[model samples]
Structure formats: structure tokens, C-alpha cells
Target chain A: MNHSVVSMDATMIQTKGLTRHFTVKKETVEAVRGIDLHVRRGELVALLGPNGAGKSTTLRMLTTLLPPTSGTAEVAGHDVVREQAAVRHRIGYIGQGNGAGHTQRGRDELVIQGRCYGMGRKAARARADELISALGLETVADRTVSTLSGGQRRRLDIAMGLIHAPDLLFLDEPSTGLDPQNRANLQEQILNLHTEYGTTVVLTTHYLDEADSMAERVIVVDHGRVIADDSPTQLKRDHAGDRITLTAGHTDDARRVADRARRSAGAEVTQSGTSVEIRVLGAPQLLPGLLVDLANDGVTVTGAEVARPTMDDVFLNLTGRSLREGGAEPADAGADGGADGGARAAADADGRTTQNQEIAA
Target chain B: MSTTVAARETNTALTGTAGPNRRRPSLLHDTGTVFVRELLPVLRNPFSVVFTMVQPLVFLGLFGPLLSDFPGTGEGSALQWFVPGIVVMSCLFSGAFTGSNLLFELQTGSHERMLVTPLRRSALLIGRALKEIVPMVMQTVIIVAVCMPFGFELHLAGAALAVLILAVMAVGIGALSYSLALASKDQDWLFWTIQQTLLFPFLLLAGILLPLDNGPGWLRTLGDINPLTYVVDACRLLFNGEIAAAGVLQGAGAAAFLAALGLLVGIRSMRHST
Candidate 1:
């Protein structure tokens, strides 16, 4: 039904004020307060947020896994609630939990998923074979999913989602539990798949590099609302900007350079000891002029380095909290609390948070 | 790592549109697939099958001999009279408790995975319920064959009807059990507390340990309202060669009612469940 709509580069996902709130033990935790997001066809968008950011809740509502408390989402040109089957048929979702049966062999699980999507057995088998080889899952395809390592199983979960070759693929933190090497490998495979199939791929992750490297457009969600949405480069340029660092012979020279840099370039400049850090919007071309002006101003520049801002810098510029801190939580902090509770209940329901954090900012 | 190779293959082989199963959605096919997946694990673990059978067999071995000397066991032996109750009890335990596996499924994320699929929620419940039927039938048949040496004379057609009754009972119980499991998704204690509380009362009221007909008036009246009492009665009538009797029909009717009710509850719960 979606394919019948003849427009090229059609809008793949459209949500308007989609919100969900849960009453966990008499406390109403607003997981996703309200979020409006749009993704055109063939775009790889990453929902970048921390643990309680409500990125997972957005994906869940978009994928038709959970109903939004208010507002609406149209995924793959079908209303997530009214035409759920249509949406479900057109999209492949691989949730954060990997969404796989433990005892089933990875290949068989893939085949069943293919069948669920309405693929003929022969076609399902062929696609399963191709995906197994392409994803480097040939080694683990025949093994029981429970026996496979987490990385291997996650890859298999990817293969399962890819079985039907859906128009849109939703991955909720695909690389969360993966090691660095495997994360990179999976990222490569995902990018390759998107490029090959031209599927609208939306993933959520708190991993700075994964989002920075994998997604072309990063939709930064916090506390159930979109904080910033743009290409990684553009977001960096708009929010954090490029930083030019100049090391002077003395702290007096550093301060003089910082003052001149601030006045002449109209940039945000700060000096620490003998180093002056200037955050300027168009750093590359502005640097040469600023250096020449600094020389003209009689400030000796000992060393200079231009560092492009990272996603974390962009996040810091947007929200005060750090993403790395969410990852470095104590091992037992969320161990037994996996069952439904305040923050986690919303987490499980595809919820969001940090709206107050955003509002306060 | 080889992006070019994958991209080249994708250009040549992959299509622009995805949305399989869009043309035809068959309930039987979907249910069949789930049934196979559900049963395969049980088949692999022989220990589970043996463990389930132990309870019913224990009822037959320990209770059957004790009742032989006691009065009120009509024409045939006490083992023959007691076998149907044991069969239904076994079916009740094995079938109604299939939800325990669902607890594991939910924990493992498999249940959530299934829900995201295009498979109908009703089909999901039915498929899981169907998994209990074949095993319950097989277990009941084995119990009947075991009772043959203890003066148990089973009418061929009646024996077949007894299997049907057990299967129907299992479907009803299995569907209801799954509903409860889905409602109490991750809360093992909530499900178990309700399950244990309801189960023994049904067993005791159905008079699985003794015939309630000879019991006090109040107990017999309580047994009359319990659906399992009718099922056990139907199985008894079937075992004693009353396949066409009104009591047999009533028993089957009670089971059918439970099955239909369980299915309704199961489907409704599944629609709202995780």
C-alpha cells in the first residue's frame, strides 16, 4: 500500500506532538512529553540521547510498539495507531533488547521473521543466506541464539530485521551492548545496508562516536523532546562551533590575545594560563585573519591548533549533562531495577525525559 | 567492511520497495509457524516432558491403590474410576502452566519480538494454546494405556473422545493462563500467586481426589458450578461407554464454554499486552 504512493523521496516518518506519560507507583513520569520529528525517505537519522532521554520511547511509538499518550505518529505513510498493521508491515524494528528468541537458531529465526513479513519460504531462505554472508553471520547462523555472544546475537538480530527488506528500519540503540570493534563492524554493515537498500534507517544511541560516525542527521532528544536536530557538521557549527587554541609565551600574552581575539573576531574567548581558546563560527578562514590581526596587535603566537567540536560538545552546548556519565553508571545501579518502575517504566514504554532539563536551560 | 561490494550487489539485486506479507495474511500459516517454534523447544528438552508426566502418574500409582479397597468405585476398578480425574488434572497443570514458559519468553525479549510482527494477536494466543493440545492428548493417551492392566476397559471411540476432551480442556486452560501471564508480564509472583490460589480450589471442588457425588450436599453443589467438574464427569462418562449421553454433551459444552471464554480473554489481553 505504501509503495502505491508514487512520489519519490516521500516523507517516511512524521510525528506531531507525540507524547506518552506513565503513572508508575502513583507517580506520573512524563517519559515523552511531546515530540515532533520528521524523516524523509532514505535518510539515516540517529536519535541521540542519554539513558533517560526518551529516545527509546520515540522509536517505540514510531514503530507501533507502544501507543502515544497524546498526539500522533505516521510511520512509513501509515498512522501508527489506526493503521498499525500497515505501519508494522512496512517497517522492520530491532529493539534495544535484540528482540530474538534464545533457543531458536539465528538462521531459522530470520526465516520465521521473513515469513511473518509475508515472504515465501524460498525467498526467505535466499535472503537469509545473503544477509548471513553480508553481515559476517555465517559462522553463527546455525548456532542457537542463546549460545552466541552478545555482539554475534546483535548481528543476528540485525539480520532478522533485514529479512523482509522493509522500507524503514528502526533500531533502538543497536550498538549499546556491543564492543568497540563489533560496534564499528555493525555500523559498517548498517551503513552498507542503508546505501544498498535505500531504506530509511533510524537508530537511537548514546555512544558519541557511533552517532557521529554512522548517522548523517542527528536528532538530539532529551527528556522526551527534541533539543536539536541537524546534520552532525551543521549541529556542531550552529551550537558548539570550532575552537581555535593559541599558546602564548606568557599568561599576559594569552590574556592580550584572548582580548584581541574577542574584540576583533567577535568570538567567545577564554584564557587559561598561557593558552587562549577562542570559539569562532567560521574558524578555518577566520583563523588566518585572526592570527594576522594578532601579529599586527603585537601578540606572539607560540602554538596554534584548530579543533573541530565533537557531538559531546554539541550535546554540552544543548544540555548541561554529559552523555559519557550515563554510560559510566555503576554496574549494579540498574541490575535488579529492570522491572517496571518510575524512570524504567517510562523507559520500557518508549518514554522520554529531560524536558524539564531543557526548559530550565 | 567491503561497502562497495555490498552496494554493488544491492544495486543489482535489491528492490526499491519493501512490505512483504502485504498480499495475503493467513491465520493458519501464522499459527502453524508459532506452534512449530513453541513445540520444538519442548521436544528438545525431554526432561520437561518427563517431569510433567510425573505428577499425573503419581496420582495414578499412589491414589489408585488406596481407593481400590475403599467403596463406591462402581463396576470397574478404582484405577479406572480415578484415571479421568488424574488425566484432566495433568492436562490442567501442563496446559495452564504453559505461561511459565512465556515468563521466560518475556525475559528473553522473544515475546516482544513476536508482538512487533505482522502476526495477529489472536493467532499468537491460539498458536500457543494449540501447542498444549497435542501434548495433553499424548499424555492422556499414555495414562489410559497404563490403566489397561488395572481393569480399565476403554471403548475405542470413547478413548478418542477422552483425548478430544483433554485437548479442549487444555486449550481453555492454556488460553486463560497465557492471558494471566500477559497481564502480569514480568511479575512472576503476581501470576504464581493467582495461579496457585485458583488451581487447587478447582482441583478440590472437581473432586480429583475423590468422587464429590458421595460427598456432602454443599460440596457437590460447589462441584456442580465448577467447569472442571463437568469436564471430569464427561471424561468419566466417555471412559464408561456413555459417549452419546446427555451428561457427556453437557461436559463437552462446559469445556467449549471455557475454551471460548479463555480465547476471548486471551485475545483481549494480548491486544493490550506487551
Candidate 2:
């Protein structure tokens, strides 16, 4: 009811060369190298990275939790450095861990959060009641925070942040420790929050599918800088294409099928025995044609399945390394690199894929 | 804690509507809210309430009476002189230990959560400082009340001054302790080391246990330097309603100065903290 509509393209966050360096053990660790990023109003952006990536650091800087060692970032239309109070007023932040007092009841915590944002007693009470019901926390609202389960505690944390009804919310690894069922439940709740309030959400997650499913735009961060930023579909399309596999009744038939698929523009086909693997951009549309030609050529197409790429594939294709390995493989080259010139060449290929995505956008 | 996602159907009114300007929570209100939150644990937990009150009570019951007959205790009488010291001791101990709550908050990530809010940084520290004051006053009252049953004479204005001095001492020490916690959020050992070590010097030099009248020259010199000495001296005189006494006035001045110092350190540490 108190919503104030903002322009569609108005910037919600803008950063120029935002960087942070940490001195650990008397040695400099460039946690966040230079990374320039922008997010428009109402966009749900995910900062996806492996464990050591600076995604959390970037979120901390934007939320006014940590000061950027260098560069500038303006969040929610307020400069993070000089105008933290102003930025804090318009946004809610839920960190990776629980943020409420241990023994306090969930309702009391929410009410206190509301009061901290300057709400009057009756109004804060009403708001706490509204939040308890909105987040489906009525069951746990009366329980002490220490007694609630992880998922319930996470929801209560979100309730605390939302008590003031911020326009923009920052969540750091929101679903990291939850079971699959609880993780899915929390995602649904977050989505509901975004849809109902029209809030601009910025969350960080390492899970491939979580980012792909929840974020409208995913910012792939590695080594403290933004390596790629685009929609999940666009990222997969440009970095890794669809995989189409076809099997025939005979090795000769498979060879024939591969020969024909190879003739199609940009179709990379490999033949072995009775099976043929085809990598192409538009697999669904070409699948029918490929099957027909093979049938007309006396090759019985016994099996066919097309698979799509995931965020992991995008990471592998971009860094020539796997995020599952903690992104520790040097970008330039290794066993995981290029798919050939080692790791370094593979890393370059990943960089090119990111450039292509930027160009396409 | 069991993982209980209640079967209550998924639609309700928990979604909030308060906006940035829907209400500007006043600074005073925010501080009060945080203060109340800090006070709840103390009241709810029997162990905490008992522990906070027991030490001073023991000192007053066992230590004060034992020292009432010690030699060279001066003309003020042992109980008369010792009560003021105990009062100051209560403030220092309660206020300083109150910071352990801050240390707990830091460990639990609640401190960081509070930082991200619109609540003022100063308010967070001030709220906790204010919470410490309540117990400090309560314990001081109990200490004073116990001394009354011991034939200890009372000066109405002096007793009031003593209570006020206790609060000032608490605020100052609590602020300093909180600052130390903020500086190193997780190194609780460091806080304990300082708490266990630095406090004895202040307590002993302030002459809480016995009169320092005939102590070595160095001990008396240190007492003169410690703010507690003036406070203890003033509290002793004020309890007799010696309002015009210079020592009473000096103790008030010292208490005010220490409160200001503690607050300065507290606010500076908090403002500059992450």
C-alpha cells in the first residue's frame, strides 16, 4: 500500500571500478579486483560464484556492511560510502547466518527491527503481525530464535529484514545450508516477496540451478571481478550450446547419419559405432530434419535425446575450469582448460564466450 | 531445533507495507527498543539475574563487615568508608561485564545485523550502556540498603550522589568494554585478559577492600590518580549527606569525566568499526 512506483529503467545500483583488497597474513589478497556493474530497478540479479569468489564481498560493499577499498558504488540511489544511512533506510539485508537475538521470540525480533527503522510502537506491532502472516511465520513467530529449525530461522531472518518493507533487499547465500526441500521452500518465499512487493532483489548463491532458476540476470563473479552478466538462457546459448545424441541400428547407419548432420551449417558431429553426437545451436528445430534424412537413407534412428547446458557448463566454458573444484584451477590453462591447448587456452575460450555474450546483449 | 515447516497453508498477511517514509523511527525510540531487548535476557534468565546481583551482595555481606574493624581504617569507621568503595565496585563490575553481551552479539552475527539497519551506530552502543545502568543502580541500592542494617548512617543527598556516581562509572566502563569488543569481535580471550587483568589495579588502587591511609607512598599516589578514588571518597561523604564536602563534589566531577571518556571511546570505536 505504501509502494512508490519508480521508472522502469532507473538505476537501482551503479558501480565504477569497485574493488577491495584484503591483507591476510601480511600478504595482499586481491579479493575483489576491479569490477564495474549496473542493475536497474526491480531486477532480480544473482551474484553467482564459488566459495572464495568475491560475490559476498561485493554484496557487503553495496549493502554498506563493508567499505570498498577503492572505487565507487551507489546503491538504491545513494552513495554507499558517504550516504550509508540513506542507503540503509531503503534496503533490507539478510546475511548468510541468522541475525536475530538468540533467545528473543521471532515476533519480538521483527518488532524490534521495525522500531530500529523508526516505526511507532503500535505501527511496529501491526507491521510485525503483518510480516508474521505474510512470510508464513505465524507458527514460529512465538518461538525463540534458537529453538527454530534452519529453514524457519532463515524465514525469520527474512522477516526481520522485511519488517521495514525495504524497496531493495540483499541476501547473502540465502539457501546455502538448507535441505533440498527447505531450499526450494525458501526460494519460493523469496520469489513471493519479489513478486508481491515488486522489490529489487540481489542475492548471492553458488548452486548452479539456484541461480538459473531464481535470477532474471546472473552476474558470474570470479577472482573478485564480474566475468559475465546476462540472463541464464543467453549465457547457456552463447557459452555452451545444446547437445543432441542420435543412435542408429548399425555402425554403417550411424556413419551415414553423422555425414548428413555434418553437412548442416555449424553442426559438429562425431560418430562412433551406432551412435552419433551432434552439437548445434538450434537442436530442436533440426532434430526432425536429421531424423528424416537418416530414415530416408536406410538408417533407422533407434534413439534420440537432446540435453541443454547448465550454469556449471557456463562456468567451465568461461574459465576453462570447473566451479565445483572451487574455481582454483588457473584460468589460463590446465587439465580443465580449452577442451585442448591445456588450461590457459581453455580459459581464453571462456573469456571469448563472455565477450560474445556482452556483444550479443 | 527441529525442522518444522508447519502445514499451515502458504498465504497470509506477513508481507509488510511500511515504507522508508511510512515512519521515521525516532533515535530515542530506537535506542529504547534496543535497550529493552538487551534487558530481556537478564530478566528472563535466572542464572544471569542471580549472578549479576550475587557478587556485590557477597562483598557487602562478607567483605564489608570483615573490614569494618581493620586497623588504621581512619576516623570514618570501616563500614562507613567501605560501603562507598563497594558501591563504586558494583558499578565498575556490572558495567564492564555487561560488554560480554556485546561479545556474544558479535559472535552470533546479531551485531552485524544491527549495523545494517537504519538505527544509529551510537544508539546501538548507547542502548546497551543504558541497559547496564538499570542493574548498576539496582545493585547499588541493595548494597546501600544492606549497609543501613549494619548501623551505617545515611546522608540522603550523599546516598543519591553515590547511586548517580555508580551509574556514571558503569556507563564509562561499559562503553570502554564495548569498544574493546567491537575492535576485535571474536577474540573473547583478549577481552577476558583485559577484564581479568586491568580491573584489579583499578579496584585495589581505589581502596575498595580496606583503607589506604597508611599504605605505601606509591599506593596512595596511584589511588590519587585513579578516578575511582575520588568517587569512593565522595560516595562515602555523600552517604552522610555531606553535600558541601569538597570530596563529594570531586567524586561527582570524576564520575562525570569518566562517563564522558567512556562514551567517547565507545562512540569512536563504534563509528569507525565495520
Candidate 3:
């Protein structure tokens, strides 16, 4: 299929220069700056960023929970600013917190929420049962949400958001607190939801692996603006630095071979205790040659491995700061006092990298 | 929690998932949804039910008899003179309790979820207000039952029905109080500050537990203008079966004024919240 042709007919969400800002204590913070984005129907777009990168704020605006400071956005063909009600009708937003009430039983709460959205009592009850089974919540459906584990509570939150069957879904940090297994389960569920319901999903996360494994497109934001948008493979080939870590049988042997390896590979090599680290571009393909040379020189190599670049590398390349370093630039980047400036920038940059990776692939 | 596509597909088939054929939910429908949800939590909370009913009964027990001997407390017994007060006060307190839940929901992000739903925004406040009203009425019934032991007689000649009507009006005022509190975003401290500043003049002017007739001329006029004073006056007449024509006018006016005020505030706040 022609990609642009399909995309033109499948625009489930589009935003142009969408902006939001807030002024606290006489200091203006621009959370979301001028930016353009598009998500096709049934597409799972991962928005990756560090904390305070305007991810939550962007979701809030898209879901109609917060008004945009300035800009135009349309979700499901409804204007976010002029037709907020219409936008709301088509989207389900699962916020950052565990949204389910701890005091109420999961089933009871779901039924009540369904009714609040105008479902008949009998219909709501039936929907509750179905969701409970679907989300694997049957065992604890009748129990208070407070008793559910972190993963279960998170699933319940997703269930509550989905009860209304909105066409577009927004999940902000859905797996932030989940264990690895639970996070994987959530990723599968999100993928299945997209296939089954044809729902367009936009989720924000701090985990690059999660973004790589799930999102069809990735958007990275930093300093309140988009820096990269691409697919995983293209980003890895284009912006990621090559990684080479070697462990030798002896520390002295590793040190003796490190300078020669750097001279041969023409890369920056550093030592960490018994292991040597080599960071280079296109170095993975050169590992065999390097290993052969090491053997000829009579240096015993216990272990050697080469790794391609990651979102972490892409992040460091663009922002000169690791994702763990709070992903923020200077405060001046958020001069408009928008809560989502940072998040939106991170999401946009991630998207760009993911797009680049896909192109390269 | 692991999820499967088959399960979601089955549920979608059963519930009629959103599509081109789906009808956009109307405002009335959305409000009804919010109203039902709000009532469910309140009805299920035993603590709220017990507190609402028991607190007023205690007041009737401790003070009703003592006030019977006081001049100008026209009634069959001490408890009878205070039955109407118990009903109004109980409804007001219950309404305040309901307001606290709304605040809690907002702070906890429950309200934020609702805002993103297809439901009408007004449903948030209106539904909550109605929830508070139902329990307030139920508490009024329980307190009236307890009042009967202390010679709390009701004029069986249709006059008892008048007191019930007063209870409804009091509930409306209470709803207004809760809606206002929610508008402040659970900033109960700010509410308390305002409450403290307005306390004395409001109490003296409204004459909630006392008669406006006992105040100075200007103060009496102020009390007459106060909605609660009129509510108190009407309760006295209706409970005693001394339903004078003027009593009906005074009570009806107060109730109408309160109902209108509450509705206005609730609607306006819900409309512009986000």
C-alpha cells in the first residue's frame, strides 16, 4: 500500500502548533511549544520523554481535560478547542495516577462509570462482567481496588477508561510502576486493543525499550520541542553510537589490549575495572576483524560483544544529556509557562527518531 | 493483568462499541449517569448514613425538652418544638458531607476521568447534588422516627407533610453549599476562612436556632430577609399544624429562593470548570 495515500485517509488525530503554558509565582513555563503531529487510525504512537517533558500535559489537552494554551488540534475530526465535547466523545484518557478508586470494588465501579456515560443499568452490568474477564480481572473484580496489586490496579484503570469505547485512547505513563512481566502484559494488551477495536493509541513513557517494542512510530521531546521522530531501526542506524564491551580473563590482559583495539577500531576506548568499553560508529561489523587481530597478538579474549545504538544514545546525542538526567534543557526553553512544553518536545523527538529508524529499516 | 483480543472482541460485540452508528449521548443522559454514580457511593457508605441520622437525634434529645418551657416555643412538648429544626439541620449537614466527596474526587483524579467522558459537564455537580439530597431525605425520616419518643408529635392532619417539604428545601440549600465547596477545589481551608469571617453576622442575621422576633428592629428585618430564618419559621408552623396563610407564604418564598440560588451556582460552575 502507498503509505502517504493510506495516511491521508487514516488521520485519526492531527495537531498543528498545539501549545499550553502556565504562570506560577510570576514565572512563565511553556510546556508545549509549536509542533505538528499526525496519528493514523489504529496506530500505536509511543511518546517517550524524561519527567516534566510535557507528556502528561499534552495528553490532558488532547483528551479535553485541559484547554490548549494556543494551537489547533483535531481528534476524530473534532476540533479540540471549538468542539471539546465532540473530542471528548471520541477519546478515552487514562491519566498518570492509578485512576480507579481504592475504596470501591472494581466491578461495581466499572458498572457505575458505564452508567454515568449513559449506558442502561443492565447493559452497564454486562459490560462490567465482560471487561473483568477481558482484562483478567475476574479474581479481584468483586474486591476493593485498594487490595489489587499495582499491575492489577493499572489494568483496572485501563478498563475504566475503555468502558465508553472511545475511538482514540490516551495513556500517560501506563506502565510507570509495573514490574517487567506486568509491563510486557500491558504492552500486549495495548497491541491487542488496537487490532481488535481499531483504536488509535497515544501513550507517553520513559522506557525506550517499551517504545521500541510497541510503538509503530516514536516521538522524542526535549526542551519543550520535538527533536526526533522515526521508527526504532532507522534511529539506531542513524543516530545511535555503536557499543563494544569486552571482558578478558585478566585485568592486565584487557588493559594491554585496549590501546591496540582503540588504534585499530579508531574509536574512544575506556576501561571499567576488568571490562573495556569502546564506543564507535559502524563498529559492530568490525568486531570479527578486531577479535582476529587480538588472537594473532596472543591476547586471550574471554568474552566480546558489539551493540547497536539505542534511544538512550539518540537522547544523549540531541540533548547532550541522558534521559536519566531529568531530560530538561534550560528553563528559558519553557518561557511560555506551559505545563506540557517539555513532554511534548520529548514526544516529538522520539517520534522523529522512530520515523528515521523505520526509513532506514 | 494479561489481556486477549478475543475477550475484547466478545465484549465489543455485546456492548455495541462506538462506531459510525453510535448515537452521541445527550446532556440529560450524561447527567443521569453522573447522578446515579454519585448516589451509589453515598448510599453504600454506612458511616455517612449513621452520622447523618444520629447527630440530629442527639440534638433533639438534649435540647428539645429544655426549649419546650421557654416562652414563645408554641408546641405540644419540648421535642415537638425542635422536630422541624432537626430535619432542616440534618439535611444541611448531609449536603455538606456530600460536598466533601466531590472535593476528594477532584483531588484524586476521579473527576478528571469523568471530564474526559462523553458525559455532560453539568452532570458532575448536578448528579452529586442529587445524591446528597436523597440521603438527606432518608436521614430526615430516621430523625423524625427518633423524635417521636420525646413527645415529638407531628400534626397528622396533613401538616406533617409540610415539614417534609421543608426538609427538601433545606436539602437544596445544602446542595448549593456542596457545589460551592467543590468549585473551590477542596480548598476547605479557604472555605473555613470565609466561614469564620462571615460567622457572627450571618448567624445573628439568619436566626437559625432562635426567633427573629427577639432581635432589634433592624436585625429583625435582616433576619426576615435571611433564607434560613424563614425556613426555621415555616418549620415551627408546619410541625405544630399552625399553618397560617402568612406562614405558607414565608416558607414557600424561602424554599424557592434557595432552590433557584443552588441551581444557578451549580450550573454555572459545571459549565466553565475546564
Candidate 4:
């Protein structure tokens, strides 16, 4: 076990061309494409993708909930396929669905969860008390979980995952429906877990802000493949170019401003509202000339602002599609489809459109 | 290509080093975790406690008195015969209700959370089934207490032994029912309705209220073949101590077989659905 632990520290998680596919009604959908990954000890890694980007599938495969179609995923130095029990013991997972029994009090659930992990009743109870107090669940500790607010319940779910003090924790969209405050609280809890306990965390999220703030490293998955992997700042620096927005006088003048801006900046421009936004690698050098060029050509600019790009921009650069546009047409195309399927498709489309629109923009 | 590299880098940065090689959990541990999580809701909810107690009481009271005036009211008082049957019925009814919790958990995302845990596969079934057993046993006790004055005598000294046997049967059946609920996650109403409809038919057909000899030939044969009939008969014989050693053994065997079958189906169904 110590030897395994040494190797585990060397590579807490390692995957080679890991892939997962599903056949739904005879249509084979590749949810996780071939990819290689190596996770190190005590890191908080965020799996970021749009709805169908396969973030959950990746988590599922790594967690042993779903087997990989090809390649291999090893967790804590054990193969997810063959040594699933080993993998399972070392990791704690809090999936998108919350997975709580509402009728139970928050603290009681944690105690039982600990006991299930082989802790004695006394030990489990002590741990439960510690977590409930640590997570600020004291007020709701004895309340039936069903009576808890959404955010409180999610917090309890996190507490439950940590009851066994697993070395690796998997959180799938942990803050999906949480309020801003709850989301912040959860982010703090995650950071605390990593810092204080040296627990490794692998989480998936659609919230770019959450990903940027919470995750030390971000993995942007698109169409079942790794689209971008880097520190948030590095990713923004690499793919999220400088953004220049020119608010036009009117909608009628939007396209003309966009075309001129596009040519002058040697970048792509898109019209949103009365603004023609241009994204270029070097916005400062290009901006002055573009402003002058527009002024000389009698194009009136109401305002201009240059800002650093975001994860959404990084996504656009990688997949050529904008995340926001995926649902511009239908709000519920994926509703009633299982949670995984809907999420997978959304993430995939986010990746594809980010690339396509990166070129078009 | 650059995008993929960046994404790969990000993936590694976040999840790479934190998973699999660590100390994983065991089956016994995981099952216990799941069971404790499930038990809370059943124990705390007012409705659950009421339903568990009231349903059995209702069956014992309504059926016992109605049959008392009937021409064929046999040896003991109607309440005496009906009490044990309802006690068995409580276990069966509550066992089937286990599915509701699974269905709700799936809908609310709790099921998915549990799936990701290293908790043992058997834990889910065991935890849920056990959670249900306490209430079921309580319901049986209440029914027995209520029927004491009505001429139904349940040997209290032997209550623990009887409850233990009944509990094993209940847990097995509960697991089967829970698995069925998971398989039909979104179609709970349909599944539950089907379960309810199947209940009385199986109950009546199994000879719960009357002896197998009293029913029509086809009915008697159906009772002989019905699993419910076996369970009721087994519980009755054990409670009445009418069966000699062979009869007790046969009843125990039948209960065990059905319980095993139920557990197998339930676990298998859960694995497939999850």
C-alpha cells in the first residue's frame, strides 16, 4: 500500500486516450473522445466545457460510474477498469444530482456515510460533528435534509463526500443551481479542503467564473475531446485574444463598422447590440490605428473599450462557437433527455461553435 | 490543436493528481454508508411513521371486523386470524414502498451522488430496505397491540424472534422493489399503481384471510403457487407454532428463496439502471 501510495503521489491520476461512447436508440454518440491526462497530488482541477462537452462523462469514467470505451483511466495509481474498488475507496464524488436523501437530517446522513466507509459509530459521529460545524451546517444539522434549502442541501452533499476524508474528491457541477452566496461558500469549502486536507479535487462546471476562481487548472473539453488545458490566465493569454468593442451610432451602421474593424485589426468582428466587437492578439497596437482609420473614413465611434478575454472567449477560440449561442434557438431541446445526455450535447456544441464562431467572429 | 493542448493542460492541472491510487473503500463500508443515509428519512418523517403504523392497523381493523360476521369465520376470532395476516401484509406493503425513496433520490440528484461514491453496491439496497424494516416492524407491533383485546394473541416473549425472521424477508423483498423503482425512474406512478393492483390480488389469492382449503379449486391452486401465499402461510405457521419442525423449515426455506430472488433482481436492476 505504501509503494502504491508513492506511485499514486507520482501520478494521482493518469489517463491515456481515454474515451467513452454510448448507443442511444442505435445512434452511437461518442461522449468522451480520446484524450490523455495526468493529475498530480493535492490539486483542484476544473473540467470546464459547455453542456455536451463531455465533462461529466470524463468524471464518470474516472470515477468508475461509466467505463471508458477505449484507452485507460487510472486513479490513485489503480486502473478504473480493473481496480475499481481501489479507485472507489480513494475518491469521494458529489455528482450533479445532489444524491441526498431529503428525509434525513444533514448531520445524521454524514455520520452514516462515514460508517459506511467503515468508521465506527463513535468515530463517524465525531467526524459528522466536525464537518457540520466546519461547513456551517450547525443550524440545519438536525433538520430533515428535505427541509433544507437548495444551497444548504448542496453543502450537506459536500459534507457527506468529505465524511470519509477521501484523498480524491469528484464534484460534478457542484454549484449548478446555488445562489451566489452558496456558490461562494462552496468555492471556499473546496479551496479549504485542498489546502487543509491536501485532498485532490476534480470538478466539472459550466460556470466559467466559478471555474476561473475555484480551479487552479482548467480543462476545456469539447465534443468529447480536450479542447484547451492550461492555467486560467494562460488559457486566456493563449486563446482569449484582446477584445475591442466599438459601440456604433445605430444598428444600420453595425455591419459596416464591423467590416472595417475586422480588416483594420486583422481579427474577426461580431455585432452585438450597437457594438462591433473585434478580438485580436495585440489590441493596444491595433486599437489606435483602427480608431484613426475609422475617424479618417468618417465612421463615428461613440465609445471604445479594450478588455482581457474570458473562458467564454477561450472557448470561442478553441471550438469556433460561442457558449451563449448554443441555446439561442431552443431553451429545452435537451429537457427530458437524461441529465448526462443533455449536459454532454450542450458542452459539445459549446466546443464546436466556439471554434466555428472564433473564425467567423 | 493548440486549443486541445490548452484544454489538456487544464484537465491535468485540476483532476490529474488527485484520484484512484488512494485507499479505496470496501463493500461492507459502502453498504453501511448507503443504509444510514436512507434510514434518516423514514425515521424522521411524520407521514412515514403514520403511514407505517396506520396502514397495518387499518387492514387489521377493517378486515378483521368485516370477516367476523361472515359465515365462515373460523376457529379463532376474526381479529385473531386477521392480525397476523396484516402483520405480514405490513412487511410486504412497506417493502414495496421502498421504491418511492429510490425514485425520489434519482429525481433529486441524490442517486447520482450515491453512484459516484465508493459505497458498496449492496449498500444501497440494504440501507433502503433496512430503513423500511424498522417502520415495518413497528407497524406490526402496533397492529398486534391493537388486536390484543380483540382476541388476537401474539406471544410477546417470542416477538423478537418472529420480527427477526420477518425482517430478513422484508429486506429481501424491499431490495427487489427498490431496484424496480430505479429502472422506472420517471414512471413511478405507473410502477406504483401496478404494484398496488398486484398486491390484493396476490394477497387474496395467497389465502391470507382464509385457509387454502376454503377457496375454489383454481383459487386454492393459485394460492399454492403464489409467492405471497407462501410468505403469509410461513409467517402464520411461525406465529401460531402450529407447524412441527418440518413445516417451520419449509416455511423458512420458501421465504429465503423468494427473498434471495428479490435481492438478485433488485441489485441487478440497480446496476443496469445506474
Interface root mean square deviation per prediction: 5.8, 8.3, 9.3, 11.0
**Per-residue lDDT for B1-274 in model 3, tens only?**
2235534543454223422213567767766677767665555564658765666667666656567566655535756666776676666556555555656666666777777776776667666665665776577667767767656676764345565556456546655765655555636665455544544455446554555666679888877677766776677677677666587678778877876788677777666554
Error of 1 at B93 (Å): 0.9
Model 1 Cα lDDT, one tens digit per residue, A113-199: 777777778877787787777666777888777899998888778777777777788898888778877776777777876886677
Q: Using DockQ as the measure, name the better of candidate 1 and candidate 3.
A: 3
lDDT of 2 by residue, A1-361 (tens): 4434334447889999998765433434566778899888788999988766778778888988778889999887789999888888888899877888887788888878887887777888898887776667778888778899887888888878887778788998899888998887778777776776578899999899999999999999876778899999999988888889998888988888899999888888998888899988889998998888877887888999998888988998887778876654456654543232222222222322222222223
lDDT of 3 by residue, A1-361 (tens): 1122224567888899988665433335566776688888888888887776767767777887667779988887778878887777567788776666656678888887776556677877777777777777889988877789988888788888877776678998888889898887788777877876667889999898888888888898755567788886677656776888888888887996696677864587898767998887778677888888888888888888888787888887777678765546543445543444444444433432222222223
Span of 10 residues, lowest total lDDT, candidate 2 chain A: A347-356
Name model 2 segments beyond 4 Å from true: A1-9, A244-265, A269-278, A282-306, A329-361, B1-15, B20-26, B43-47, B58-65, B72-78, B145-156
What is candidate 2's local distance difference test score? Answer: 0.77
What would the TM-scores of all predictions be?
0.87, 0.86, 0.84, 0.81
lDDT of 2 at A265: 88
- For each of the candidates, the C-alpha root-mean-square deviation to the true structure, in angstroms, is 5.5, 6.9, 7.1, 8.2
Q: State model 4's lDDT.
A: 0.71
The DockQ-based CAPRI class assigned to model 4 is acceptable
Per-residue CA lDDT of model 4 for B1-274, tens digit only, reads 1323323332223322212223445666566567656665665664665665566666666656777755544566666556667777788777877788777877777776666655667666766666667777777767777777766766664455557667777877788778767666656676688778876787778666666676678888887777666666656655665545454565566667767887788777666544
Query: Which of the predicted structures, 3 or 4, would earn the higher DockQ when compared with the native?
Result: 3
For each candidate, the alpha-carbon lDDT, in order, equals: 0.78, 0.77, 0.69, 0.71
Ranking by lDDT, best first? Answer: 1, 2, 4, 3
lDDT of 4 at B190: 62
Model 1: per-residue lDDT, tens digit, B69-111? 5666655577667888888898998876888877767766778
Interface RMSD of 1: 5.8
Best by TM-score: 1
